[model samples]
Target: MIVYSNTISGFNHDVDQGIIAEKVHNELNQKGFYNSINEIRSWENSLFYMKNVLYSPSINQDLNIAIEYNIPNTSKRVDFLISGYTYTENPIVLIIELKQWEKAERTSREDIVTTYLGGSNRAVTHPSYQAYSYAKTISNFNSYIGDNNIEIKPSAYLHNYKEEYRSELENDLYTPIIKKAPIFLKKDTIKLREFISSNVKKSDQGKLLYEIDHGKIRPSKALQDAISSMLSGNDEFYMIDEQKVVFSTVKTLVEKAIINEEKYTILVEGGPGTGKSVVAINLLAEFRHKIVNYVTKNSAPRSVYFDILRKDKYSLNYIKNLFKGSGSYFNSSKNEYDLLIVDEAHRLNEKSGLFANMGENQIKEIINASKVSVFFIDEDQIVTTKDFGSINEIKKQAKELGSMIFYGEDYNLTSQFRCNGSDGYLAFLDDLLQIRDTANYDGFDGDYDIKLYTSPTEMKEDLKKLNEINNKSRIVSGYTFDWVSKSNNDIDVFDIELKDDFKAKWNFSNTQTWAIDKDSFDQVGCIHTSQGLEFDYVGVIIGKDLVYRDNKVITDYTKRAKTDQSLKGIKKNNNFVLADKIIRNTYRTLMTRGQKGCYIYCEDENLSKYIEFRLNKVLKKNN
Candidate 1:
């Protein structure tokens, strides 16, 4: 996935002609990327600065070079990569994160710094950590590096930064990452050159680069399997990028809170498959020495986690106490808990309790009751009217409680560990669902499988076949049916009755662990039973609530089952627009639950046709 690769001599020639930026842009265009003027100009300047560093004849001119090399299975790309052999003739790759920051300011938070970027002073990841993360991601997922013992050296080059203020970025808070990935300033030409020439001794003639480009990337571990293994002491998950930075940063903050009696609130925002739950569970495991609880408003994920731990034969009392509802903090005394790791924070309601009347606010109560509170939330994934979580809401609560707030890259998760690690898939989904106006989204670029079936029975049969490999594929639908089987004594009663004799019951009557239950795939799951969970593959049934009419996507609240609480009070407010969004978002969440693939069926033929058409166009573009 290296968009542009050449020897140092060839790269220098392009730059000497002042056409390196044009060449890079052309390479990117061939791969369906359109860079803005600013990015193009930055590439030009960064390459010029790199030219100075590589001018020494002591450096091998035959060293392999790459620009904008896309990480396998992920949409993220490294700015520059150099491949060669070390002095000992071992395969090595050097990752360089190019930056143009003239200055930066330190924040109270670890792993975060504020700098002028994108025309504003913004909180961003420290250059050192960013570079280290790029290397870590490659080593972890791209098994070629790990299996072949390829050493990766990561560093950041701030060619525009002055030497006088190096201490600002070299703060003690960032010492750990800086040690792993050093930072070079504008005036450190000799230093940077020495760093390169010291490691890269011999050229590989692109052999190492070819293996890197064609190497196998390990598939993402099944979410349920990973969580279950995590519950044991195995720790089968690896945190990458912000997941790593966020983990270390929060660990430090939690230590401060426990040792110094400091109160802090961290707000971590990320979309689906950003490994939110994985990170939350990692924290729960790390701080088990202290009184800690994994809190969430969703019972589906909790049930699945509890089941996973139960299989390990953890004590029943420990399981119950470890996985708690958001409502559990309503009546706790101040700082009663050492740490609160809240997942699905977007589903937290304003009030706590069965009837939503116990607490002033769930966010406020959690902060009040814990020495340190960590919230993992995604507002767009808020599928119900009851969801009260948002970036603004958490900050407001933290401020009101006089708690130190940790935001920005230090607390956010950005890497996509699902949907085959294709950010384009999520962007294409947003465009298809009309959730936002996404530009240039043809399709996702990954090995993720997406299929549209005209027949519901066909979808189920295929998905059921997939589930046979591992009990990790199941069918979920919008809340478009009632639980008739729950009320009937007849075991034959079905809750979901589709045309063409497609009949099934909801996972409601099944065990709480429907997500991983062996026979549960025979039943259908609603948004409640599937949210905050994932599968190897999923079959989604888009009901009559959503359809294509007159060349536009439409939602009909009346078509939804009356028992569904997702849009309960929205109709009363005549919030048709809001209801429409919920319906679309509900499906979006369901479609994305599959890690490897997704199968879809629509009740409306016209809707099916429209979706098939859109999917075909994307497939063609990707091909």
Candidate 2:
């Protein structure tokens, strides 16, 4: 007899016959990867755990199982099997009805176990529970007699099935006793729950079930062990727990690369605070390797090497001679390091493709440049609003390229180490990315180190105060009228006020005071002047042009990028939607750079409200 396995294959088509309840289920089915029951369970568990993992790592739910006693004169046995890990002294983890294919409904609507599944058992007599019990019994009977058998129907033996097991559970007389049982232990119980609750899915059902039963399922012990090892000891540098190490999986993998000292290619994926950049730094330090070539989309070209310079830690002059290009200039020994670490690799897009404008994949260049290649891929961190920046495509590229090479693999850093020590932002981020992620915001304080000030006068006062603390380090700048060096005029006011005095106030005329000019502030530039760059403190000036027009949706990104105009025969155009997306992304990047603080100036109330809403939501809920 065929047992209906949860791991259904080739079942992506809509099966209106109670396959799944709604459009959401259909959407999940179409994703192709959600083929197995285990996968479905994992998706739900991950979403649930994501809500509390960071904020309440110790939180746990106690599962209970109880069976009703039935008493009468006859010594009859009505067996109802309780599945899951049966405990000797503890409550049953899961109670399941054992029904043969001969019967359709296993339990009646009055069965107490129906309400005990996902909901609490406190209200067993609730209307919902009663309905479930009755419906289940009927369903169980139908399943056994003739479910999906077309011609056969249950009307044939309807009387014989219902009368037999009716008294076993309904009355309060039959005493329960354990017959045979496995060793009941706490760790094993937790492990069992975690195992059965694993999210990984397999295409085949029989094999999957067997695998689960035999303990061959899950995130391998190796991965968990690695996470456990790193998290065992608390770090003096950072206040964190064992679970926090999951967030640094990327760091661990990179450190492994350094120790192995062998040619390897790795793709690390995660949301913010996953420690991609910091891990890169530590990896380079551990290997004593010189950084020859560096590429980034959102990081400031100058600040790309900020950590090393700030600490005077290591020399990476070898990069000067590795390649020849507009920004290629480094000095170091021959073959200084055979490792290439690309930060924000998701930003490497089609426009940035290598092959000297031949449209060859640029990532291939990085892979070929070093014996070992490491990429920090975060599609959520695409700040430049460029078309080519996507981590999803990068994974595909890596797989396709790896097929041509000898070895290639990818890993996801599970925990979010940055964006504060909490997981709220990570939860929201998962939802934003449309992944089934759940997280809690308990005890989270939604406050940022940076403050948003729309008033220019208030901004100036704040910047002055911030600068007083560390003028050389803290930068105060805004977009300028003429930051676009290629433009014919110094400034193009597409939509804002402040154009009349933006550059002059920043003393742009004197190159030493402003970093935008090659001849001037080689280290510091105003916000507009520092496009594509970041700093310790970025004070953004949202000029008056930012307004919510009645029909204008600044989020509509229909314009060709500054780099894309050459490919398509179209001049640069500013669609509000695209502009809004770019602006938001830019702000996110800018705000995140400050190790300490950030400030924003936008007179527009709607835009301010939006910014405050997002920022506050992340900060307050993510603790």
Candidate 3:
């Protein structure tokens, strides 16, 4: 939605009155979004300068301008949008990605430049491409543009950049995107006006933006469906905003690494459903001809993807070998491969192998085995005690390996592609688990089918019904129950037994792809088998490991299944801190596996009631 919209003349008056920034702040506050003081100040500075850019008499003063247009289903926003009609009276929108930079330097990576941001000189997405990607994101997901045929023009305006450094920003490496979405420096204000005027010569009463804002948002395809299409040599998941920026930046770095024989490491940090796997898969697709391996500590995702993507048994030889466990590279020679795209990098262990005595560090070994390494990580998903992956560890390894490192918004993924594109859901989840204090303590917005159930039988019945529709629904739980049938070849031995005759089996010991197994619905999955994957519906069974006690969420380490490996030795010297964290994170991850819905069955009545109470505050309907 447009936080603030007005005629060009009206915006000029507001800027002249020095209330434009205040208006934006007020509107964002009304929408329950947080804006920092620096962001408000930046808006103030940019709007004041934008007044000059829109002062041209040749341009239509009656044209509409919008500030901070919230893109549908994503946390990213358009900095500025001007809506008007083309010369032939067709509706069009100009998306301007505004940047306030005084100076910048060229990076060897294409579509990337080093600039001062966030208190450091970091590699950032080139402005023109950023603008283009934002526009493309809007067009791709917002159904209104395609339905109505409204034209979209994207460009970047760096009001503080000098004319002397024009050549640095105008590199040929970014030509294709720059040609599509031109960049305007302080000196090019008149040129920018001419460009804007050429596209939008008349006003359209701001109706186009109203429709665009209210347009229907196309839902992200199911993860397995997207992966199948992508593996079949089709571009199923289109990279949006930073996903595109990170993809392009990595491509450039890989090129440099291959041509110059240099080592480079890219670190991308994003929360769940931020398209980390999509980006990693796209990278593998792009570099399929080269020697590259897709690595992850968990085999669930790799196995499921291989199960879906493999065309036939004979075709699995090369494609199957491309996916390796994190421990596979421990003994590899230095620079043994070209690229190692590690997803769920936070789950990597310090040591490799089943005995955990092989490698000094998984991060160091992976980086050593590849000329260019890309790590997709979310620190919050480090649920196990052995998860040794972290930003500090990766940076340390890169430094010791003498590899160039890149990490920042330029490489970070922020869009919420999962959980129905509701970042509020994730924030609410964080607060629900008491993992972190957040503004979303009550609940989240969106039609995510979440319900707290007092009866495990009801939760499982509903989830099983959902599974019948697409086989995309499954039940997973915390490691509260032991695998009593681990060595027994019988399926009747139940590991999880709930009241009211509710009983279930852990996934069969030899079931490789438990996620998609046709008869797997009757079995239960744990954090190890459910991580790095998603489903349409999920029923989470919260165990006594976590309990709502004394008006707050608490954990009992000893309640965890004695056979569970995730928290091995976590209780040593009373390591309740880590145990508590892992327990909460496990439930959080389990509950979020559902794209459409999440049902909960809590072993503790207090925890179940607490969850129901919190969810009732935000969700209109709760069972």
Error of 1 at 144 (Å): 2.1
The clash count of every prediction, one per candidate, is: 0, 58, 0
The order by descending TM-score is 1, 3, 2
lDDT of 1 by residue, 243-264 (tens): 7667777888898898999999
Q: For model 2, where is the 10-residue window of minimal lDDT?
A: 68-77
The TM-scores of all predictions, comma-separated, are: 0.90, 0.44, 0.86
Candidate-wise lDDT, in order: 0.85, 0.35, 0.85
Candidate 3's residue-wise lDDT over 280-351, tens digit each?
999988888889999999988888878877744426887667889999887899998899999999999999
Give the per-residue Cα lDDT of candidate 2 at 535: 37
Q: After aligning candidate 1 to the native by TM-score, how far in Å is the CA of 240 from where it should be?
A: 4.9
Worst 10 residues of 3 by lDDT: 614-623
Clashes of 3: 0
